[model samples]
Target: MRDIHQVHTLTEAVLDPILAREPAAPRVTYYDDATDARIELSGLTLANWAAKTANLIRDEFGLSPGARVAVLLPAHWQTAAVLLGCWWAGAEVVLHPDADADLALVTLDRVDESEGVGEVAALSLDAMGTPVRDLPVGVTDFATAVRVHGDQFLPRGAGVALDGMPVAEVLAQARKAAARQGFSEVDRVLSSTPWDTTAELIDGYVAVLAAGASLVQVVNPDPAQRERRIVSERVTAQRG
Candidate 1:
């Protein structure tokens, strides 16, 4: 077996394991109480999104490893694609608004109002991955732009280390914590936590990927629907 760390990119380490598993299995399911939206992604479908987004970042944006990208969207299933895609391109992800970034990704509703420090992209996050109805003046439609790219990517270079910790170290730490928390392939995790902090970074994103478990994410959750989701999704663990 090839060592994932030998690949020299965080994307390779994080995605390689998941790709080795059942591609047809459910990888992420998202529910939005405010919008009454539900979207589910199989491992293969999620990977396709990641690959296409990575190509967009690499080919269109001309961003190289270590370039920072601000992901200004909510915790929708599409956010998963963006996060994975950024790592796949060997770029760093910045969720904080104040952070410096070379590119900015925002929700379609926020496109006209957003002032990009550099390049801007709009994500519809709609059930059908539709393009925005009224695209902002300077923003590219993410769903439309990514469609032309192929569904396979190979990073051309290695990513730079962040704060003395490389991507490999981050993955290792998240995997260790996930293992200690009893997360595994057989478990289905329900994450109600907002993806706005460090804990959410490790627990919500990295841990689920590391554990090879499916994630059921709730955005603007409703208490009444929680039990129904837990039962329907076969959730074995809860995090908030």
Candidate 2:
């Protein structure tokens, strides 16, 4: 067996353990509507989705090991899958703002044009159907990239280090934050904010996923009803 040092990406680390686990275990749950307040996913589903999407990322964008891929998406199950997929493929992921121009510019400067960077992918969440523009040279729509790449799981190096104070530890801390926000096995998550929103970043995105709960994103939810739905739906988690 190869050592953890031989491992190359986040995707590899997450998927391997998930695959090794029993299929009956809960892994991921996708919430697209408000009908359900409590939802959970099995471990098998999360592993399969991560593998499929990771394969798509690899084949479509030609993402290589240690490359950085920026994500601009809402807080949906697909978003989590893609982020993990990128990591599985050994690519670094930068969460980017969905609408702020200044932040977008800063993110671009920080991530784009850097040497050893891989493809930069964008996701359009505009309700106005506005055209996406001004993306960096290699930037492509994430959906298009996935569609172009067939579903296939190609294993990479060993996996990420489970050693002292590693990235996984950081993820664990994020999970603890989610639990503090009320996320539990029986609760489903809904976000009125973007996935990259600061509040969602610290509390909802990583935390909800770590808690193994389903997540839903309301792109244009009414501000008045936002809190009501969150409470009624038992959305234990919030972007705080």
Candidate 3:
């Protein structure tokens, strides 16, 4: 595996290498304080989900390198899979709801907000892979939809990483953010930060990938569980 610094995108530099080197190691762990749910993914498993997502977007939605994918999802393990898939398919991720996109990835409640921008796929956010209930007639259920796709995929090529920024620039910024936060490959970071913007995405999400660090991302964090998670998850660093 090459160094993390030698990267075109996270899917190429980070995910691919991690899968090749430590396919069974826990790379990402997620927690939902509201539901009291937890999920863990190894590098191979994450790559499989990402490959399925890439296949869905590239084949079903006709998305390519230049296409934009609006992500209305939160910071969860599934979100990480979707984002990696988008990057693998060479689509630019749009965090802003107002942006035009070829695809919109959203949770069940945000269906109406993704209108006016291509196709929409709703996520149930259920760890059990349940299909989202009451999805609109045209809207696709992400968990069910993504499952039909094959786990093997070839890159369509890479473009901008997020919004209008170039892929190289976005990754470089993420690397800097990782360094600023003192991230290292051996660290397991527990993070509660929201990736609601490009900057936050770089700081909270991409930085972990850039540094080749393991992640324990929490949403709706329960304060009481933080200490327990740090010990249980063997977290070496904290990020918010």
Candidate 4:
């Protein structure tokens, strides 16, 4: 595996090592409450999704470096793809839909109601990442469009920072936090905190990635099922 120390940006520093060292290792496991849906993405698979989403943002939307893309989805696997993809496309990610942004990726319900968003894309988050059958006039279906794109993406320039913090600093802080929390490569970290905010970027995703650990996230979790899953998945640490 490439040394995480040599990487500059969050994308390269956090994700690339996992993809290189253990491409097939279980990286992210997600559970949704409303539908009792479960989805898992390995290192290679997550990279592929990120790449496709990057292509969708770069090619279809014509968004380049310095552009802002608003992400309005919950803490699903696809949200991870969209977040990484935005950084891969050299654009900043805005968490709020109303922020000044060039494009917006949203859930199905928000497609019709989100006004003033430059362009709108919808994600179904189905088992297959399916596209909506009847999208309102101009909304792009993310899942369908992403499938046709390439599985790998290489940005032309160096990595960029978010929220005025250098990417390297962000990783360093995450590492310190992870150490304090007793996280390590041997641990499977379980996080129930909503990964929709900027705080989660550091505390949830970065911390786990920095430790070379995997994440088990439960959305709308049932108490009984959560206990079973923690044991089944061998989760060692938790953040709720």
Candidate 5:
């Protein structure tokens, strides 16, 4: 396992080490109240998804360093993979839908809003990774497209990170946020916070990675399930 303090980029520094040491340990656990769905991703599993997403961006989409990919998804495990994948592919993740992006990722409900993008992929956010059917002519189904991509990625360069921020800067912010949030390497963090902005992404998601902590992310959370979830997941920290 690589030393967390000695690492730099998000994937290379935080995730890769988990792959080397804790391949089977759960890194991210996701829940959706509306669908009554839950998904757990181990370190190696998350890396595989990130790598496939990277391959889809680089090989299938023909994107390279500095390319902007607009992401209009919510807080979920797939969103985590998408963010890491873009960084792994040396592409920047643009949060807004109309950011003049080369690639756009959105949910089915927002597909109509994806104008001016060179390419578009709609995610179903399905627990079973089902492909979205009946998509508009130009939209690609992320589940279907990503399944055909490779699971081992070698980035061509170290591109800019979220919203044009540098990788080092983002990772540094994550480290600080982890400390401020009282995160530790052994903590199992439970966060209901949405990664709607660059700040939230750093504070909520990246901090867990930086601190070598596990995350139990809940979207559209059910208050009644909160206590049960914490107990079931063995959560040690809480944040919203």
Candidate 6:
């Protein structure tokens, strides 16, 4: 049997259990412009999308295992999904507002300029239209990649269920399952406070995404809007 130390990536740890579950079960929720979009992500869909996106990164930028990718964007459900996708592809993700340049340098491979900076790419998120650059290497526009790849992805691995289940119980089950699968300590993440305070991310997100029930990231502007987000989105976690 493989020991916890042997596990290498987040995809290997969580995919099987998720795939075994029902698709209609709610996996995550996001709030945009006062509207909430809840995704009932089955294990199959999550695994497939992550794999597809990972493949896109691999093929387009030649990112290998252990490469560092920086994602500078808001904490939406899709952002979380993309982070999982990066882990699935065997790469480390650096969240936005990262201040440690040395830490960022360890495995830096591709940087999505549309989100922030570290490297340059063809994609830009500016609505007013910024001038495009013709760079020789290291930059990518994530939106374009998703567009080119299309929405459908091939599924991989078996699935599990934590749907409609209490957060605590789901976490316990996932922890036991992950331990059996040989996933130990993954990373020490310092997420930008308040938003990162949720039990879901610390308990479920990081533990399930990274190996060994450990790991994890940011943001500002809008107090009244933030309050609405908490109430509408059901974010019961404490605000910093």
Clashes of each: 0, 13, 0, 0, 0, 14
Candidate 3, residues 1-240, lDDT tens digits: the string is: 333223365478667667766788888898989888889998889899999999999999888776889999888899999999988888889897854788899997888888887899999978889999988999998898888899988884676778888678887888899999999888899999998888988899888878888899999998999999899999999988
Best-to-worst ranking by lDDT = 5, 3, 1, 4, 2, 6
What TM-score, over all chains together, does every model reach? Answer: 0.88, 0.59, 0.93, 0.89, 0.93, 0.50
Q: Report the Cα RMSD per candidate.
A: 3.6, 7.1, 3.8, 4.0, 4.0, 10.4
The sequence of per-residue lDDT tens digits that candidate 2 reaches over residues 129-189 is 2334565665554454455444456656423311222345546666677668777655566
Clashing residue pairs, candidate 4? none
What is candidate 3's TM-score against the reference?
A: 0.93
Off by over 4 Å in 3: 1-9
- Residue 210, candidate 6: Cα error in Å is 8.4
The lDDT values for all models are 0.79, 0.52, 0.85, 0.78, 0.86, 0.43
Quote the positional error of residue 53 for candidate 1 in Å. Answer: 0.3
Stretches of candidate 5 exceeding 4 Å from the true structure: 1-9
Error of 3 at 32 (Å): 1.3
Tens-place lDDT per residue, model 6, 1-240, is 323233345555555444454333334433333333233344455555566566665566665554565555345444555656665555555543343211121111223222333433343332223433443354445555544553343323211112222223444655764455444443222223332333444343545443422222223333556655555444433323
Where is model 6 poorest over a 10-residue stretch in terms of lDDT?
100-109
lDDT of 5 by residue, 120-207 (tens): 9999988788989788897999999999888899766765777878678888899999999999878999999998888888899999
Answer with 1 or 5, whichever has the higher lDDT: 5
TM-score of 6: 0.50
Assess candidate 1 and give its lDDT.
Answer: 0.79
